[model samples]
Target: MRDPLSKKVVTIEPSGIRKFFDIVSEMKDAISLGVGEPDFDTPWHIREEGIYSLEKGRTFYTSNSGIKELKIEICRYLNRRFGLYYDYDHEAIVTVGGSEAIDIALRAMLDPEDEVLVPQPSYVSYVPCVVLAGGKPVIIELKEEDEFKLTREGLLNAITDKTKVLVLPFPNNPTGSVMTKEDLAEIVPVLIEKDLFVISDEIYSELTYGRDHVSIAEFPGMRERTIVINGFSKSYAMTGWRLGYAVGPAAIIEQMIKIHQFAIMCAPTTSQYAAIEALKNGDGDVEIMREAYDQRRNYLVKAFHDMGLSCFEPFGAFYVFPSIKSLGMTSDEFATKLLMEEKVAVVPGTAFGSCGEGFLRISYAYSIDNLKIAVERIERFVKKHCE
Candidate 1:
């Protein structure tokens, strides 16, 4: 038989984060700190809304862009939370997940070989998505010295004539780095001068600690050029709901919705109704969960330091990226050894990108008790390996 698969699809590697997660799933008594999902349940009020929607038999598909009320609520949430303003009717589209929004946004914007500047040690999907969308993926390896935040020099160095988009994965996954307004200001000029567009993934915005999360869209002259992607998965503990939305200029959003229309008729009706409740009444719930995560974050950072691991303090997201280079093992080797010896599963940093070697991403979304146990096991594993 003739080969049928697109070489582009064949060349992409599977997600490294999921490899360990799958193994840990089958193992008995294994504690997984690998997945970047919230441990909290969907708040009662949100669940109740979904149930009410079902009870009312509202199982029909919404408009290609999504229901008007949900879109309005999304706009309100973005404006109230981050000072971002988008026209609900024309500038937003509900998606299956933040992942889907990312996929379609790239599809809507890129022509073949259009260069996409992606900072590395970011969420795993950006590079693959760019490739699938027929765009060239240019990686900027973020440095730990800069707290893994993308620097102005780094952005300028990666841009060229072909550069069309920059995937801004702030409050970053794996590294837990966030770009402040000052930090963002440094790069906005470069973006404007280069005339580059941005896909700002702000899924972790509400999970920020210490400082308020700032959006690049908030910068002057950026609203039209930036696509903001966010969802309830991280903040409202609604991962399984598979709901996310993208807000941007209407021209771009209109094109994205065309792709979304044929690819996915709409996001789930139940999830949409539930999300309305989440946005309107779930601020307190988010705060409570954020506080718990903050407590766990503090505990784990201290534990890693006490155990002699040089861990950078991450102020956003629930992950701590700790350098395992001192032990003289590759990130994969260290993670595998730790899992086998301690039965604790944590993602190797290489999963995010090649630059993530010598590190490991440990999530603190688990309870304090679980974190304590995991820390104890990690400490023991480190001691054994170091000896």
Candidate 2:
């Protein structure tokens, strides 16, 4: 019989993050910090809106781009919070999630062998989506010494004649690294000079500490070429709601909608209604969650420090990427042994990228009490292993 699967699909590896998560699910009494989900429930007002929509029988599909009110709300929300702007009628699209927005944007722009610069460690979806979309993904390994922010030299070094797009995953996943306005200033000129377009994933925009999350699109001349992808998942705790949106040049969003309309009729109608409420009145809820996450983040950093573990302080998102290089064990080896002996589950940093080899990505998105317990287990394991 002939081969049934496409070689392209087969060549892509499944998400390494999920492997440990699956094991922890089946392991009794295991404390898994492997997932990146917020422990908070979707804010009450948002849930109420979804219920109201259902009661009103507003369960049908929305326009392929999204409901007009929701789009307008998204624009207003971005402007109020992050100082970015977009036209509701032309430059916005509602997607199934930020993940879907990333996928469709790559599909809309990439042609075979068109190079896309993907910085790692990042959200796991970028490289595979680039491959499936027929783009050659060129990885730019972000350095810990640089706080994992993409640098001007790195951007210039990665670009070539074939390079067309750059995936900027910021207020980043796994590493919790965020790009400030100054950091963005350094790279925007290079992108403009190289004539490279950008896919800026700003899903964690609301979670940054000390400084605000800066959008590449907010810089001069970048608005026309940068696609900003964001969603209700991390910020609103609306992951299950499955709604996200992209705002970019009308030309790009139009093409993305063409793909979105056929592949997905629209984002879920009920979720769209819920997200409207989320965008309109959910700031307080997000602030509360962000504060809680900030506390957890600080506690984790201190715990690692007290135990003599090497962990950089994360200023955004609810994760801490701690180096396990001192333990004389690979990330995978440490994570596996920690799970087996200590009954605490964390993802190896290599799950995010090859350079993540000596690190572990532990999420602080759980309760303070759970975090304390996980810390105790981890410290015990570290002492045992280090000895």
TM-scores of the candidates in the order shown: 0.99, 0.99
Question: Would you list the clashing residue pairs of candidate 2?
Answer: none
The global C-alpha lDDT for each of the candidates, from Candidate 1 onward, is: 0.95, 0.93
For each candidate, how many residue pairs have backbone atoms clashing (under 3 Å)?
0, 0
Candidate with the greatest lDDT versus the true structure: 1
lDDT of 2 by residue, 242-344 (tens): 9999999999999999999999989999999999999888989999998999899889999999999889888888899998898899999999999999999
Superposition TM-score, candidate 2 onto the true structure: 0.99
Checking candidate 1 for backbone clashes, the offending pairs are none
Worst 10 residues of 2 by lDDT: 209-218
lDDT tens readout by residue for model 1, 152-248: 9999899899999999999999898999999999999999989999999999999999999999999999999999999989999999999999999
Clashes of 1: 0
**Candidate 1 residue runs with Cα over 4 Å from true position:** none
